[model samples]
Target: MEIQSTKKLVFLLLFLPIIYTTAQPLIHHHLTILNDKAALLAFKDAITEDSQAVLADWQNSSNVCNFTGVVCNYQQNRVEQLRLNGGGIHGPLSPFLSNLTGLRLLDLSENNLVGPIPPELSSLWRLNELNLFGNLLHGPIPDSLSLLSGLFFIDLKGNHLTGIIPSSILYNCTSLGYIDLSENALHGEIPPEIGNRLLSLMFLQLYSNNLSGKLPPSLSNCTILKWLDVENNSLSGELPTQTVSRWKLLELLLLSNNLFTSHDHNTNLAPFFSALSNCTHLQGIELAGMGLGGQLPTTIDQLGMNLSSIYLQDNQIFGSIPPTIVNLSNLMVLNLSSNLLNGTIPDKIGRLQNLQSLILANNLLIGPIPPSIGQIDRLSQLDLSKNRLSGEVPGNLGNLTLLSDLFLQENKLSGISPSIGRCESLNKLDVSFNRLTAIPKEIFGLTLMENFLNLSHNLINGPLPLELSNMKSVHEIDLSSNSFHGSIFPQLEGCAAARMINLSHNSLEGKLPSMLELPENLESLDISFNSLSGEIPVSLGGSLSLVQLNLSYNDFNGPIPTSGRFTNFTSLSFLGNPHICGSIPGVPVCK
Candidate 1:
C-alpha cells in the first residue's frame, strides 16, 4: 500500500503543473471579460439621458457580450465592437471604454455626447475604427490617438473639436486609410510631415474648418488618395499644381472658399487645370469663392469624363462659356455664377443631357439664353439672373417638367412666355429687375409656386389676375414696380399660404377689396405708390403675422386698427399717404 501511494503522488505532482498551465488562460479570459463588463457599465452610467432607451437592455443583460450594441469575439470572451450610433443618448463619452483592450471598433456617432475626447482611448491598441462623428463633443482632438498605430479609419467630423491637426497623428498613424476631421474648429496648417506618410489614405476630408496656410506640397505623396475636401478653410497659397498631379486615383477635390491664388500673379490657372487631368477618376471639382483669376481654360474638358459637378462661382473667372464643356457627357451640375464671365453662353450647352442644375447668374454674359437648355430633360434648377442677357426665355424650357426653380431676375428679359406655365413642378420663379412686359396667362396656373412668384420691377401692365388666387400655397407674390391698373382682386385672398404680398408702385385704383382677408401666415404687405383711394381695410391692422407694412403715396384715409401683431408698425409703414392716420410712433395721430 505504501509503494502504491508513492507512485500516485508522483503522478499527481506531474499532472498538477499541466492542469495549472492549461487553466491560466481560462482564468485570464474570464477576468478580461469581467473587466469588459465593468467598462460597459461605466459607459452606461455616463449616459445622463437615453431618451430612446437604446441602452435599456445593457443593464438587464447578464452577459456583457449580449448587451446592446456590444459584439464579442468568436470565443465570447472579449468585446470587439460597440456600435451605439444615433441612439439619442445624451451624455459624455466614458473613458472607461479604453479598458476594452481587445475592442476593434468603437462607433458612438450621431449622439449628443458632449466633452473632450478622452485621451485614454489611445490605449485601445487593437482598435481598427474609431468614429465619434455627429456628436456635440468639444475640445481638441486627443493627440495621443496617434498611439493607435494600426487604426485604419478615424472620423471625428461634425464635432466641436478645436485645435490643429496634430503632427504626431499625421506622422505616426501611417496605417490610416480614411481620416475625416471636417466640420470642426480645427485651425492651423495641415502638418507637412504627411509627405508620403499616409500612403494608404484614400479619403481626407478637412472641410469647413479654420485651417489656414499653404497646403503642404508633400500631400501629393498619398498616391492612392481618392477624395480630398479641404473647402471652406482659410487656406492660402497658389493652386497646388505640383501636389495634385500626383493624385492619380483622386475622385473629388473641393478647394473652395479659400484664399488660394493661381500661379503667375493669379492669372495662370493652366498649370492647376493641367495637373487635374492626371486624376482619371476625378468626378467633382469645386473651386468657388477662391478669388481665382484668369479665364476658364478651354482645356477644362480634360478634367476627365467622369467629372459630373463643377462649381467655380463667386470668383473672377472670365471668358466665354466654352462649348468644349459639352464633351463631358456625365456633367450634372455646373455653377459659374457671380463671376466676371462675359460672352454668350455656349449654345451647345444643351447637349449636356444629364445636367440637373445649371447656374450662370450674376455674370456679364450677354445674348439670349440658348433655347437648347430646355433639351436637358433632367434640369431641375436654372439660374441665369443678374446678367446682361436679353430676349425672351426659350419656351422649350417648359419641357423640363421637373423644373423646380427658374431665376431670370435682374436681366433684360422682354416677356414671359406662356410656356413657363408648362413647368408644373415650378416652385419659385423670379423675373424681377427685368424689363419684362406681358404676363403670360399660363403663369396663373402654377399652383406649385410654393416658394415665391416674383415679377417685380418690370413694365408689366393690366389688372391683377383673379387667377392669382389659384396659387393657394404660394409663399410670396411680388408684382411691384409695374403698371397694373384696376381694383385689387379680392380673389387673391384664396392664397391662404402667402406670406409676403407686394403689389406696390403700381397703378391700381380703388380701395382694397372689402373681403380681403389676411392669410394665416401673411407676414409682409406693401401696396404703396398706387392710386387706391378709400378707407384702409381694417383687416390689414388685425394681421396676426404681419410685421412689415407699406401704404405710402396712396389716398387711403382711416383709423389704423390697433389689433394683432400689426401694432408694432410705425409711421414709416404708412408714409406718403396724406390721409393715413395711426397712433403708432412716426404715424399721424388718428383724428
Candidate 2:
C-alpha cells in the first residue's frame, strides 16, 4: 500500500512539469512569430529605397514583438496589431504577412508599394481593419479579398488600380463601414447589388474615375449611406428624384458630369431641386457640363441652402432670368452663356453682391444697360457682347473697380460715358460696332490697359487723340473703318507701348510722322488710303519687333528704306504710291 501511494505522487509531479513546459513558451512563440511576420511585410513594402535602412532595424531585430509598429497583447506577448502608415515603402507586398493569424489590425497606407495585392493577405482571419491607400498598385482587385470576414474599414484611394470591382467582396463584407477607391482609373459600373448587400456601409467614395452606365435605382436602399460621390463619369440617366426623399440622412450626393435631364419639357425642376431641401446640410452641388435643358425652377428661391458654389454652365436652359435668384446670397459664379434665352437682363442681377463672373453673351437679350449692374462690388468679369442691347453705357461701371475684362461690342450704343475711365484695373476693353463719335480722353488715359483696344466699325471721327499716349501699356489698337481724320500724329512715337496700330480707310493727310521712332516695339503698321507723303523711315528698321508694315495708296515720294530690319519686306507694302522708288520688287528702281 505504501509503495503504490508513492508511485501515484510521482506521476502527478511529472504531469505538472509537462503542462508548464509546453503552455508557457508556446504562447510566447506564437506572439513572436506573428510580430515578426508583420514587420517583414512592412519592410518589404517601404516606399523609398532609403526606407530600407529604417526597415532594416525591424528586419534584423531578434525580438520582433518589441519592433517598431508592432504591438503584442500583455501576459502572452501575442501580436495584436501592426500599423505602418505613411512609411514610404516601395515594393510588392510580402506573402509572409499571411502568417500573422492573430492580427486584429493591419495598416500599411500612404506607402509607395506597387504591383498587385497579394491573395495571401486574405489569411488574416482575425483582421478587423486594413488600410492601403495612396499607393501605385495596379491590376485587378484580388477576388480572395472577400475572405477578410472581419474587416470594417478598407481604403485603397489614389492608386493606379483598374478593373471591375469584385461583387463577392461587396456582398461578403458585412461588417464594412467605410470603403474608398477614389482618384484611380477604375472602370465598370457600380454593381447594382451594392444597395442590398452592403447594409452596414456608411461611406463609399468612387469619384474621379471613368465609370459608365446608368446609376442603379436600388442605390436608394442604402438607408445609412451618408456620402455617395461618383463624379466625372459617363453615367447617363435622369437623377433619381425620389432618392433624396428616401435617404433623408444623406449629407452629400455628387452626380456631376453624368447624364441628368428633366423628364418632360414642361417638367418644373422645382420638384427635383425641392427634394434636396430635406438635406439642408448638403454643402456642394456640381451639375456643370451635364448637357441639361430647361429653365431654372423659380421654386429654387424658396429653399434656404448654404451652398458655396453652383456650376450649371454648358446647358440648353432658356427663359427670362428669374428675379427670385437673389436668394443665393453666397453665389460666386453665374455662368448663363451659350443658352437660347431671350429677354432683358434683370435689373436685380446686380444685387448678387458676391458675384465674381457674369457670362450673359450669345443670347437674344435686349434692353438698355441696367444701372443696377454697377451695384455689384465684387464683379470681376462681365461679358455682355454679341447682343441687341441699345443704350448709353452706364458711367457707374467705374464702381466695379475690380473689373478686369469688359466686353460690350456689337451693340447700338450711341454715346460715350467718361465714367468708364474710372475702372483703373481694366485689362481688355472692346466697344466696336457702335455709334459713338468720340471716346473720352480719359478712356485712353488708363495706365493699367494691357490687351486690345478695338473701336472698329464705329462712327468715331476726328484725329487720333494725343491723349492715347496715356495708354502706354496697350498692345494693339484697331480704329479701322471709321471716319478718324487728320494726319497720323508723330507724337504717337511717345506711346511706345503699342505693338500694332491700324487706321485704314481714313482721310488723314501728312508726311509719315518722324515720331514713329518712339514705338520701338511696334510689330505691325497699317495706314492704307491716306494722303501721307515722304520716304519710309530708315529708323523703322531699328524696330526689332516689326513684322508687317502697310502704307498703300499714299502720296509718298522717295526710295523705301533698304537697310536694317526693313530689308525683309517686299515692294507690295509701297503699292499705289506711284512716286516711291526702292530695290523692292514691283517698285521703280531708285539709283
Candidate 3:
C-alpha cells in the first residue's frame, strides 16, 4: 500500500503540470470574452431609450457573440464591430466604448444620443469607419480624433458641435477617403493641409457651418476630389480661380450663401465660366446668395456637358438669358431668381427636357414667356413671378402633367387658359397682379391645389364660381382687388382646409354669405373695401381661431357682437362702414 501511494503521488505531480498547461490558453480566452460581455452591458446601460429593444438580447446568460449590435471575431473572441444606428437610443455616449479595443467599425448614427462625443474614441487604433451623424452631440470636435490614423471614413454631420475644426486631422489621418462634418456649428478656416495630406480623399462636405475665410489654394492639389460643398458658411473673398479650373474630376461644387466675390477683374463671369469649363465631369454648381455681380458669360454654353443643376440666384448677375444656356440639355434645375437678368426667356428654352424646376422670379425679364417652355416634360416647379413678362400665358403650359407649383404672379399675363385645367398635379397656383377680366372655369377644377389660389390684384370680374367647392384641400383663397361683382357663393364653405379668405377691394355686392362656415383652422378673414351689405354674421364673432378680421369699407349694418375673437379686435376692423356700431372701442353702441 505504501509503494502504490508513492507511485500515485509521482504520477499526479507530473500529470497535473501537463493538464494546467493545456487549459491555460482556454482559461485566458474565457476571461477575455467575459470582459467584452461586461463592456457591452455597460454600453447598454448608458442608453436611456432603446424603445425598439435593440439591446434586449444583451444578457449575461447568453453568449456575448450573439448580443445585439455586436459582432465578434471567432478566432480572437473579441468584439470587432458594433452598429446600433437609428435605434431610438438617447443618452450620452458611454466612454466605456473604449473597452471594445478590437472594434474595426462603429456606427451609432441617426440616434438621439446627446452630450459631447467621447474623446476616448481616439484610442480605437484599428477603427476603419466611424459614423455618428444625426446625433444631438455638442462641443468642439476633439483634436484627439486625429489619432485614428487607420480610419478611412468619418461622418459627424447634423450635430451641434462648435469650435474650430482641428487642423491636426488634415495633417494626420492620411488614409481618410471620405469626411463629412457638415451641418454643424463648426467655425474657423478650413486647414489648407487638407489637400496636402489627405491626397486620397474623394469627398469633403463641410457645408452649413459658420466656417469663414477664403478657400485654401492648396485645395487645387486634391486632383482626385469628386465632391466639395462649403455652402451656407460665412466664407468670404474670391473663389480660388486656379483651383476650380483644375478640378477636372469634380462632380459637385456647392458654395452658396457665402460672401465670395468674383475674382475676374472685368466683373464678367466669363473667366469663372471659362475656368469651370476645364472640369468636364462637373455635374452641379450652386453659387447662390454670394453677392457675385457680373454678366453671366455667354461662354456658359462651354460648361461641362454633364452639368445638371445651376443655382445662381440672389446675386447681382445681369444680362439677358443667354441663348447658349440651351446647350446644357441635361440641366434639371436652373434657378436665376432675384438677380438683374432681363430680356425674353430664350425661345429655345424648351430644349431642356430634363428641367424639373426653372425659377426666374424677381428679375427684370420681359417679353412673352416662351411657349417653348412647354417642351420640358418633366417640369415640376415653374416660378416666373415678380418679372415684367407680358403677353398671354402660354396655354401649352397645361401640357406639364407633373407641374406642381406655378408662380406667374406680378406679370402682365392676360386671358386665362382653359388648358390649365389639364394640370392635375397643381399644388399651388398664383397669378395675382395681372390683367384678366374673367376667372377661368378651368382654374377652379384644380382639386389638388392644397397650398393656395391667389388671383388678387387682377382685373378679373364675374360671379364667384360654384366650382370653388371642388377645392376641398385649398388652404387659402385670395380673389381680392378684382372686379368680381356678385354675392358671396355659399359653396365657398366647402373649402374645409381654408385658413384665410381675402375677397376685399372687389365689387362683391348683396348680403354676406349667410353661413361663412370657415374651417376650424381659419385665422384671417379680409373682406374690406367691398360692397358686401348685411347684418354682421353672429357666427364670425364666436370663432376661436379667427385672429384677424377686416370687415371695413363694407355695407354691414348691425351691432358687432363683442364675444370670442371679436372682443380682441379694435373698431378699425369695422371702419369705413358707418352702419356698423358695436361695443368695440371708438365705435358708438348699437341702438
Candidate 4:
C-alpha cells in the first residue's frame, strides 16, 4: 500500500508540470492583449478632440481587437490595423502608437492633427501603409522614416510640411509603390536617383509645391510608372523627351502651371507629343499654363484610344486644331482656350459623343461655328467667345438639353435662334457684340437663365418684348447699343433677381418706368443715352446696395434724391443730361 501511494504522488507531480507548460501560451496571449489595450488607451488620451466619437468604443472592458478603428489578426492574436480617417479628431499623433508593433496599416487622414510626424514611427518595421493626408500637421518629413523598409504607400499631402524631402526615404523604401507629398511647402530638386533607386514606384504626386529644377532624367528608369503629377510647382527647364518616352506604361501626366519650356525653343511640339505616343495607356494630359508653344501635333491622334481629357489652355499653342482630334471618340473635356489658335472648328467634332465641355474661347478662330456641334448631345458648356466667328447661331444647339453655359459673345454671330428656348438647362447665355436686328422672343422663356443675359453691343431693334418679364431668375441684363424704342416696361420688375441693368445707347422714348422695383441685390443701374423725359423716381435712390447710377443723356427733369445711395454718386454719373436739375454736382439746383 505504501509503494502504490508513493507512485501516485510521483505521477501527480509529473502531470502538474505538463499542465503548467500547456497554459503558458494562454498567459502570454492575455498579456499581449492587455498591452494592445493599454496602447490604444494611450492613443485615445492624446487626442484633444474626438467630435465623431471614433474612439468611444475603446474601453478597458471591451476587447482590444473589437475597439473602433481597430482591426486584428485573430490567428496571431494581435492588432493589425487602425483606420480613423476623417474622424474630426484634433491633436498630435501619439508616440505611444509605436507600442502597437504588429500594426500593418495606420490611417488617420483628413483630421486636424497638428505638429510633426513622429519619427519614432520607424520602429514599426512591419507598417505597410501610413496615410495622414489632409491634416494640419506641420514640420519637415523625418529622414528616420527610411528605416521602415516594408512601407508600400505613404500619403502626406495637404499639410503645412516644409523643407526638402529626404532622399533616404525614397532610396530605402524600395517597396513603396505610391507616395504623395503634394500641396505642401516642400522645395528643392528631386533626388536624381529617384527612378533608379525606387523601381517599384507606380504613382508619384508632388504637385502644388515650391519644388524647382528640371525633372530628374533618371526618372526614365521607373518603367512601371502609371500616374505622374508635378503641376503647380516652380519646376523649370525643358522636359527630357527621352525620359518622357520611357514611361511606356504611363496613364496620366499632369505638368501644368510650371515654367517648363520647349526643347526646341517653342518651334515644334511634335517631338514632345511623339514621345507621349509611346505611352499607349495614356488617358489624360494636362499641359496648360506651362508656356508650351508650337502647333498642336496632328499626330495627337496617336495619343491612344483611352484619351479622355486634354487641357492645353493658357498656353502659346498656335495653329488650327487638327481634325484628327475628332478621332479621340472618348474625349470628355477638350479645352484649348487662351491660345493663339485660329481656323474653323473641326466639322467632325460631333463624333466625340462623350464630350461634356468644349472650351475654345479667347482664340483667333474664324468662320461660322460648325452645325455639327449640335450633334454632341452630352455637351454641357460651350465657350467660343472672343473669336472672329460669324454667321447665324446654329439653331440645332437647342437640341443640347444638357447645355448650361453658352458663351458666344465677342463674335460676329448674327440673328438669334428661337430654338435656343428648348435648352431648359441653360443657365448663362451671352450673345453680345453681334448684329441681331431683333431679340429672340424665345430667350425670355429661359427661366433657368440665372447667371445673366447679355445682348449688348448688338443691332437689336423694335420695342422691347414684354416676354422679358418671365426671366425671374436673371441676375444681370444688358440691352445697350440696341435700337429698341418704347417706354420701359413696368413688368420688367418681375425679374426678381436683377442685379445690374444697363439699357443705355438705345433709342427708347417716353418716361422712365416709375413702378420699377429693382431687386434688393441691385448694385448698378444705367439708363443713359435714351430719350426718356420724366421725373426720376424718388424710390430709385433708396436701394441699399446700389453703388453706381447713371441717368445721363436723357431728357428727365427732376431733383435727384439726396438720401440713401444717391449721396455716393458724383457729377460724372449725371453728365450728358442738360435738362436735369438735382442736388448732384454739375446739375442746376432744384428751385
Candidate 5:
C-alpha cells in the first residue's frame, strides 16, 4: 500500500504544472477584461442616485459590454463607448474610468453629474469624442486633455465649467474639428492660438461665457470654419474685416452682445460688408446689441445672395434704409430696431419677397408704412412701434396671412384697416399708445390669439366687441384707458387660458361677471377706474389663483368676502367703491 500511494503522489505532482501552463492564457484574458469591468463597477458605485435604474443589470456575472449605455468593439473584449445622456444619474464621475484605456467615445450629457470632470480622463489617449454637456459639472477643464491626440469632437457646453479654455488643447489636439464650450461660466480671452494649430476646426462656439478680449485675427487661419458664435461675451474691438474676409466658406457668424465697432473708427460699416461679400455660403449674421455705430451702407449688398438673416438690433446705427438693401433677394430676416436711424422705410422694402420678419421699432423713421409691405407673403413678425410715423395702417397688411406678431404700439397709427383680421395666424397684436379711434371687431375674433391682445391707451370708443371672447387661448388682454362702454359680457368666459385681464380706466359700465366665469388661470383682474356697477361677486374671494384684484373706484356695493384669497389682498384693492367694505387691512368692515 505504501508503494502505490507514493506512485500516485508522484503522478499528480507531475500533471499539475501542465494543467496550470495550459490555463495561463484564459487567466490573462480574464485579467484584461477586468480592466474595463472594474472601472464600470466603480462608476456604478459613485452614482449616488440613479433614478433611471441605469445600472440595474450591471452585475459581475454579466459581461461589461452588455451593461446599459455601454458599447464594445467587434472582439467584445474591450469597452469602446459609453453613452449615458439624459439618464438622470447624480454623483461625481468616477476617476476609475481612466482604467478604460481603450475607450474611444464617452457621452454623459444631459445628466445631473456634478463635480470636476476627472482630470485623469486625459489617460484616454485614443478618445475621439467626449460629450459632458448639460450637466452640473464645474471646475476648469483639465488642460491635460491635450493628451487625446486623436480626438476630434469635444463638447463641455451647458455646464458650470470655469477658467480659460486650455490653450494646450488647441495646440496639441490638432485633429479636433468641433469644440463647443458655450453656455459655461468660462472667463478669459479666447486664445489667439485657436486658429494657429486647429486648421481643421469648422464649428467654434464659445458664446454665452464671460470671455473678454478682442477677437483674434488669427481665427482667419481656420478658413474652412462654418459657424463662429461668440455672442454675449465682452469681446471689444472693431468688427473684423480682414479676418472675416478669409472665411469664404462661413455660414453663420454671431457676434451679438459684444463691444464691436465698425471700421473707420466705428462709424463706417462698408468695409465690414465688403469683407463678407465673398462669403457666398453665408446664411445668417447677427451683430445685435453690440452698440455698433454705423449707417446702412450700400455695400450691404456685398453680404452675398445666400445670406438669409441679418440682425443688427439695439445699436446706434443711423441712416435711411438704403435702396441697395433690396438687392438681397433671399433675405429672410432684417432686424434693425432700437437704432438711431431716421428716414422713411424704403418704398421697395417689399422687393425682398422672401423677407419673413422686419423689425424697425424704436427708431426715428417717419412716413406711412408702404402698402407694398403686404407683398411679403411670408411676413410673420413686423415691429414698427415707437416711431414717429403717422398714417392709416395699410389695409393690405391683411395679405400677410402668415403674420403672427404685430407691434405698432406707441406710434402715430391713427386707423387700423379691418382687413388686418385676415391675418389668420396672428398670435399677438399690440396697438396700444397709438392714435386709434376704434378696434375692428374682426381683430377680436382671432381665436389664434394666444399670447397677447393689447389695445390700451387708445381713443377707441365703442361697445366692447362680443368677439373678444373668441380669444380662447390669449394669455393677456389689456383694453384699459379706452372708451369701451357696455355691460361686462359673460362671453369673457371663453378666455379659457387668460391669465391677466385689465379693463381699468375705461368707460365700461355694467355688472361684474361671477368669479367662476373668469379664466381658470386668471391671476390678475383690474376693473379700477371703470363705471362697473353691481354687487361684487362673492365667488371672487374663493379664487385659488387670483393673486391680484383691483376693483378700486368702481360702483360696487355690498360686503366684500373676507375668506379665501380675499384675505390676501389689502383695502386698496377695493378702495373708492363707496358701498363696498371688506375685512382687509386698512379697510372699514361693513357696518
Candidate 6:
C-alpha cells in the first residue's frame, strides 16, 4: 500500500509541470501581441518594404515602444496608435493588421501602398480614424468596413479604386464626419438612402470620376454638410435645386464639366443663389462648361460678392454687357468668352479694379472700344475679337504693358494707333479685316516680338514700309489682301531669321530684291497676285526648312529655279506668271 501511494504522487507531480509549460507560451503570446514588436512590424508593413532603416534599430530591440511614430495606451503596454505618414513606401498593404485589437488610430496616408484594402481590417472595430489616402490602391472598397462603427474620418482619396461606393458602408457610418473619395474611378449614382442616413457627414468629395445621374435630393438631410464637390463627372439633368433649398450651411458648390441643363434659367439660379446667400460664408461657386444657355443675370453682381473667381466660359449664354458687373471688384477671373453676348462693352467695366482676366471674345459687341479699359493695370488677357467693333484703335491701350495677346481681328477698326508699340510684352497681334489705309512705323520698335503679326485685308496702299525690317525679332508677318506698291524692301535681308512672310494681293512692281539674301529659317513665302518680274532665286529653294512658296501671278520671264529648294514646290505656286516655265506640276516645261 505504501509503494502504490508513492507512484500516484509522482504522477501528480509530473502533470503539474506539463500544465505550466503550455500556459507560459499562451501568456507570452497575449503580452507580445500588444508589445513594440507587433507595432514595429505593423508600421513596416504599412510603409514600403524598402524603408528598412525606418524602424531598423527597433528591430529585435526591447525598447521599440518608445520609438518614433508609435503610441501606447496608459498602464498597459499595448499599442493604440501607429502614425507613419509621409513615409515613401511602395507595395501592397499587409493583412496581418487584424492582430492589433487595441489600435484606435492608424494613419498610413501619403505612402505607396498599391493593392486593394484588406477586408480582414474589419477586425479593427476599436479604430476611430483610418486614413489611407494618396496611395495607388485599386478595386472596390471593402464591404466589411461598415463594421467600424467608431470611424469618424475615412479618407481614401487620390487613388485608383474602381466600382460603386457601397451603400452599406456609407449608410451605416453614422459617426462619419469626413469622407473623401475624390480623384478615383468610383462610378454609379450616389444612393439617396445613404445620404438620408449619414446626416453627420460634413464633407463629401466625389470629383473626377465617370459617375452619372442626378445628385441625391436626400443630401439635404445632412444639415452639417459644408463641402460637396462632384466636378468633372458625367452627371446630367437639372441641378438639385431642392437640395440647396434645404441645406443653408453649404459653402462650396463646384459642378463644372457636367451636362447639367437648366430649364428654368434665371429663376432656377435664383433659388440656388438665394439659398446659397443664406450661407454667408459661401466663398466659391463654379458652374462652367455645362451647356447652360441664358442671359447674364443683371443682379449677379450683387450676389456672392465674396467670390474670388467666376468661370462661365464654353456656354451658349447671350445678352448685353451688364453694367452692374462693374460692382464685382473682388473677382479675379471672369471668363465670358465663347458666348453670344452683343452690344458695346459698357464703360463701367473699368470698375472691376481687381479683375485679372476678362475674356469676352467670340461675341457680337459693336461700337468703339472704351478708353476706360486701360485702367485695368492688373489685367493679363483681354480677348474681344470676332466682333463688329468699329472706330479707331485706342492709343490708350499702350498702358497695358502686361498684355500678351491682342486679337482685334475681323472687325471694322479704321486706324492703327501708334501706341501699340508701347505694349513691349505683346506676343500675338492680329488686326486683320479692318479698313486701315496705313500702319504707323513705330510699331516696329517692339524688337522683343516673337509670335505672329497679321494686318491683312485692309485698304493700305503704300510701299512696304522700310521699318518692316526693323522688326528683326518677328517670327511671322501677314500683309496679304492689301494695295501696297513698291519693290520688296531690300532691307528685308535684316530679317534673315523670319519664319513666314505673306505679301500676296498687292500691286508691288519690282524685281525680287537681290540685296535680300535667301532666308535661312524662312518656312513660308507667299508673293502671289503681285507684278514681281524676276527669276526665282535659286538659293531660296535650297533652304531645307522652306515648306511653302507661292510666286504665282507674277511677270517673271525665265525658267523656274529647279535646284534644291525649288524641287519641293509645286507648279501651282508659279503658274500665273505667263513668261515662266518649270519642270514642276501645273507649270509649262521649258522647251
Query: How close to the true structure is residue 58 of candidate 1, measured as C-alpha lDDT?
Result: 74
How well is each residue in 74-136 modelled by candidate 1, as lDDT tens digits? Answer: 585899999998888898888999999999999999989989999999999999999999999
Clash total of candidate 6: 4
Q: Which ten residues in a row have the lowest lDDT in candidate 2?
A: 302-311
- For each predicted model, how many residue pairs clash, with residues at least 3 apart or on different chains? 0, 7, 0, 0, 0, 4
For model 6, what is the C-alpha lDDT against the true structure? 0.79
Colliding residue pairs in candidate 3 = none
TM-score of each: 0.96, 0.72, 0.93, 0.92, 0.90, 0.76
Per TM-score, the best of the predicted structures is: 1
Lowest lDDT sum, 10 consecutive residues, model 4, at 48-57
lDDT of each residue in 1-591, candidate 3, tens digit only: 999999999999999999999999899788878887887788788877545377888888999889878889989888899988888888888888887778899999999889998899898889999999999999998899899999899999999999998999877999998999999999999996778888888899999999988898888888888999999999988766788887889999999998888866436677778899999998999999977888988889778679999999999998898899998999999999999998889999999999999999999999999999988999999999999988888899999999999999998888668898899999999999988777778999998789999999999888878898788898999999998888887666678788999989989889976576666787898989999888887777666888898989988898887666777999878898888788878988878
| Model 2 lDDT per residue over 469-553, tens place | 7678888888887887877766666667889988887778877665467487889988887777887777767778888888898
RMSDs, each prediction?
2.0, 6.3, 2.5, 2.7, 4.1, 6.1
Could you give me the TM-score of model 1 versus the true structure?
0.96
Local error of candidate 3 at residue 410 (angstroms): 1.5
Q: Which candidate model has the greater TM-score, 2 or 5?
A: 5
Q: For candidate 4, lDDT tens digit of each residue in 154-187?
A: 9999999999989999999999999999999999
Which sections of candidate 1 miss by over 4 Å? 1-8, 49-52, 558-569, 580-591
